[model samples]
Target: MQKNSFLTLSVAVLLVFSLQVSAQDAQPEAGVTPSSPFHIFDRFGDWARLNLLTFNQVRKAEIKAEIAEERLAELKAVVLEGASEDVVNQAESLSTAVAEEVETDVSRLDEEGRNIADLTDKFNQLSLRHQAVIEEILEKAPAESREALTKALEVSKRGLEKAGEVVLKQVEKGNLEKERAEKIAERTIEQLKKQVENRSEALKKITEELGEAPPELQERFNAKLQLLEKELVNVESNEQFKDLRERIREDLKATVEDAREFRKMHNVEDEDSDDILESISEDGAKVVERVEKILSKAKEKVAELERSVAQAQTNGKEIPARVSSLLDAAQKHLTEAVAAFEAKNFGRAYGQATSALQNAKNGNKFFEDEDSDEERDENVLEKIEEANKKIAEAERKVEEFKSKGGEVPAEALRVIEEAKKQVVLAKEALAKSDFALALRHAEFAKKVVEKIGALLERARKAVNSGTSNTLRVETKTEVKNEEVERPANTASSAARQPQVRQVKITAEGFLPRELEVKKGDTVVWTNATAKPSWPASAMLPTHDVYPEKGGCIASAFDACKGLAEGESFKVQFNPIGAWKYHD
Candidate 1:
């Protein structure tokens, strides 16, 4: 009975150990899902080993393959032990797809690798041809070209060495996917081809460069050579003790070949311009793309400015008049840029867009540089005092004109009344401590007073037996430089204003040579002469008279660039003046 109990206990222990082993085997690894259609391996290292071993020829491939097979075996055991029938069916189809993808990627990588190897061989052959050519031509090449040619050869050699090192590192890492490896191979081949082509061109350039040995060209070549030599030395020193010596040996063979090819094509000129035309077309598209990007950036800046202005508004801070005007100008320029771009005038479009960007930047800078609200309020107070003083002085001048029994122009009285109204508005804004508004109103009031004082002086001059016709003054309210179509009814609109009047230029010089119109009226000058007529501001010694103070061809003051018979040039009488213009 004692012997039987010992055997039964031993059997029980063995059965428990087996059950524990089965339970552990049934459990899935971390990241392993028994029911899922797709598999995500527990570790990238395992996945990489499995994929890399198939393509790599190193001894490590055998070891990594064994480890990957064991891991897959464990995964299969777990799936078979725990996965339901439905999961097994789904995984079957998914596994097939994944297998097909792997096969395709592997095939693609093999094909690309073959292509790369072939190109590398071809390049090597070309390099040998070039080496022979370089040796043959170097003795005959001009002294001026030797330095440049030698430097180009060194640069090409160093670039090849560096590229080879990079390729070796990739091979050792062994983690790149099949697709990725294929792409890399293609890219390497492309780079090699371009490098070879460049070397050929460099060699050809020696001949051309020798034909024109200007001092500047020699200087530039010497500078570039120095830089290349320095870089080559640096590369040689850094890679000296590394295992890359053997690799460099192999690379030098190719380099020498490349150097030879460079000298071979010394006299061969380009035979076709297809590549040149293609390059130009590509460059043009790139330029247009860059311009469009600039336009987009400029627009964003303007929008940012607008947002800043809106924020200031929310805080009950008024935008300064000048700031507002600048913002308007920025917007105007941006619109013009868009129009110019649409018309395919990229040069003008870029200029206008850049201007808009700068203007918006300036506006933001102005806002940031502004004084604090309290300081601004104090400044506004001082401005009000100055404006009031100027208004008083202007009123005194007006009274003096009346005492002299001079005819006070109706426009003068109207401006004085407007000045008073602006002053009232300024005082109201000052009471509310709205400094920006107060300053704007106060400055405008001061401008009106100054304008009225000038009118009063002109009236005084009229009293000295000068013409008393209505004074037509053209003042610079805004700088208008944008090219836009004018409203067709501009003359009719000017006529509708009560304070505006008209003047005409007929077949004879000026209809009433010295006739005047009210301020803000339209002066329509028709070229009624049979010959082309130029109505321009008079330069003192030559023409002797001008319609306005700032009148010049640029300002469109008497601007008729020889209008043909029946053509007309219209000038808006904005400035207050007793002025004259002639053909």
Candidate 2:
């Protein structure tokens, strides 16, 4: 009986509403048309009539919602039209108010014993979609408009959060269960994730394109790259997102592609018409002849190293197994080079010979000194101080590079860290009263710092329109750092300091075999070895002592991991003395 009464009430209310709408549409002064009337009645008329006592309240709510929505649309258009800050802020405020009003009305309708939960959900969906459109616009906005666009995005995010809260409150009020509320919240989270993914893709693409950027654009390019890397690193390090790796695959791929492009542009060589190091050397024939000479020198050096190895064995010295392995590799490559030469493949022979020579020289460093001299070097403290100063200068330059928004190379950072480690080791040696080892470590650290400084200087130059087109390959030639004289009181004298000097190492030994430099000048040693090579002071086998009392055995320097082929180390000289070093 009650159900029949409810159906009759619903029918009567709909008939009356339809009559009123038609009467208004027929009168031109009423400014109401049948098609222009509130469509709210089409969906909610039955529900409103079920409880007719609140009919007036429902009608007012509907009218208010219609006004709010219209206002919202107008404001949205103003923002989309690229309005001024004041207008944009007004639009955002209006949108927020309208969203809040619609939500409040839905809650009121539910409170009035009306069944309108589904209506509330529909409105929320529309609100979310509106925000999506705003977000899309922000993504395409120009850099100059980023601040405004970002502000708009934040507003939308906050609005969505408010909507989620409303849903949760409804759950508390028994209008929704906890499970349903959770599902709605999950929907919002998914939307947020998609937005973040889109942003990540855009950033990665920017970083990739930055690979071929001109020098003038490097600062801006690096700024974007730095921002992307920092954000991606944060995402990667988040424990909560660990399981979402698959979702972040696109972001990760972007990072990888950026790195690959950088290496491709900087390190990886393209094949030339003539295969024998055409990009590295001028004349193929000259390169081949040089390699042949290097191979012959390696043969003699290896013989000397073998004899030392035998003596060390006889004397029961503690020999690192690495020495023997390097020897074997050296001999193998030399044999290969000989075979290539015999077959008239000069290019192949040259490459093989170069590799063999590097290996042989590296193997020889271990056997340089069979016993350490018990000498106390008085200059250890001086060398340590000099090294610290150089490292400080290098660190300052690195900071400057970062401040200018330069893309600091990972290798450059690694080199600085290595220098710091060497400093620690040097201090430990000093504490042990091993002056020779201390001095050597201090020297190595200084060299590494000089290299880092040189690299950062080059980066700074790039920001000022310098180009870095050539690969930093290890060469078997000594290039002195270019020094220019300036007035002693010039404020920018440091900026005009000489470029870093370079020293190349192969199987024969350090190219030039001797280096001369003024105090504070730096020299870089590049290893073109096929095998790993450790560079230390002229003390090995029994490195407990030095040949001269002035040399500290505790100050020894060696790259903990012997340098690989094409790798390099740099050192700054500050001591005024004749320092003798060998391979």
Candidate 3:
């Protein structure tokens, strides 16, 4: 009797273990939608599988790509079956999340000093497939679902970018062959060409449908379609595959933005004017908040300048007359901004605040001494190192705060992200021996780190006080050499005397939209719109389109951060290629 009882217990234990394994491995059978009852089990399986491979980044990334593909399939299935808007959105969001996960995993592999070429190549192919699928779905999706699908499409494009970035990094490290890289670039360009073609065709169809529409509207549509066709021709004929890829990427981005704008412009009816007004009011409130934040930052900078001036005097160093004048102008603007803000004139306040910040930056620039190439290089290197240290410290503080149960504000997170971008720009600038620009980027990054420190402290205080509110603060300072020798200029002597050109960032976009300038020419973009704008080299967020590689993310042509209203950012075009930029 005892032997029989023991055997029974063992069998029961084996049965329970098998049940647990089956549950953990549960996956939806064929034709299951995200809305189905068994979908939760499918999600659990994905999560379990992902967690199981956490230690294997390459494999994890592969799994993530697969999961993303699955999500995309679910999205297509649900859309075809007329899922509810919420359900569709959920599926799209899941697809985005999984694609982003793949990106993150690949990044981790790169960071771990592992070989990422194969994984990146795999991801690149996956992204292309995803993009094609999303585009097809976009056509069949309902209007409500179109927006979410568009977002998913953008995310897939970013995945492609991420994969390309890895491939480029590996090539630079000599881990990837040039032939392979070129092939990848060619593939991406081909995909982009297809996208441009599709967009042009859609626009043409829309133009046809506007048979009896207003002449002005018809004219605009025709003009846009013609421009797209022209770009398509350029993409196909360009022999330089890399440049072709970038141009086509920009084409797709512009097409997407224009499509959204066109929809917004024509979708509304006379009855929606009230809703539009409400939206305008809400936007105005956000602008007010942004202006207030700028004002606070300007105030801090002006005060720091004041302290620096005092220190200069105490050290028996004569303060430059121009520096004093700029400081006074900054203070004057700050006072006016405060007054305007108090009077609820947010627009005026924003202008004044931006002017104050610019003046403060100008004053700070006076303190930076001119240096020879060697000195500049050394100084920039040191500064970049210092910036990295500060970033490390800030990251530690953030982790500690989180460990202590602190809820980091979204604004603080954004600041951290900006700080990282600045550091990257600094490093890129350093790589090209653009020491002044490098130092400027590094200094900006340092300032951002300081701002993060202050924000985290404020957050900590709020946590301790059992309050959820924290004051928002940000500061910006620019470093410029009043007179410095150009680095390795190959332009003619006459062209070596750099000329400054102006581009206005208006509500409609860059005023001139395009410009042709000789080498050693500087273009300054002033923000004329109410909102802040960031101007950078194209290929979007990475900004590494210039042949000269080294600027945050991709090239040294980035503004690093947003320029507030009434402020300006300047970049000197170098190396004589047809460069593209966007805000």
- Give TM per candidate: 0.25, 0.26, 0.35
Worst 10 residues of 3 by lDDT: 470-479
| Model 1 lDDT per residue over 113-224, tens place | 4223322222222222222233333323343344433443333333332323333233434433333433333334334444455444443443232222222223333322
lDDT of 1: 0.47
For model 2, residues 1-583, the per-residue Cα lDDT tens digits are 9999997886677656633543331111111111223433432542443345235665545443443444444444454444555655554555456556666766677666654444444454545554554555543333344455445544444344345434534655677655555445445444544544444444454334332222212322332222222223222332323344345445454553453353244333212212222211233234345445555766777677778778888998755566687678777867876876665444344445545665566667655543342333346667778888887887787888778556565446756775676677677666654454567678877766667756666655543332221222111111136354332223433354645778778754577655545435667778886766656554342233322232333343344445789887665554323344544
Ranking by lDDT: 3, 2, 1
Residue 239 of model 3: what lDDT? 33
Report the C-alpha displacement of residue 169, candidate 3, in angstroms: 0.2
lDDT of 3 by residue, 1-583 (tens): 9999996775555444323543432222124567787676667666766674256767777667666767877887787566788888888888888888888888888877777787788788778767766766665566577757767765775576567557756766777776676677657655655654554455454333322222222333332322222223222322323454454555444543444344344432211222222222333233344556678888988998898899889988766576788899899989987986785544345556666876787677656555554686688888988988988888888888789666665446656665676677677666655455567678877776676667778766644433333121111111245444243322323344657889999865687765756545788999997777887664542343344554454555766667899998887755323455666
Candidate 1 weakest lDDT stretch, 10 residues: 268-277
Off by more than 4 A, model 3: 1-31, 212-583
Question: What is the lDDT of every predicted structure here?
Answer: 0.47, 0.50, 0.61
| Candidate that would win on TM-score | 3
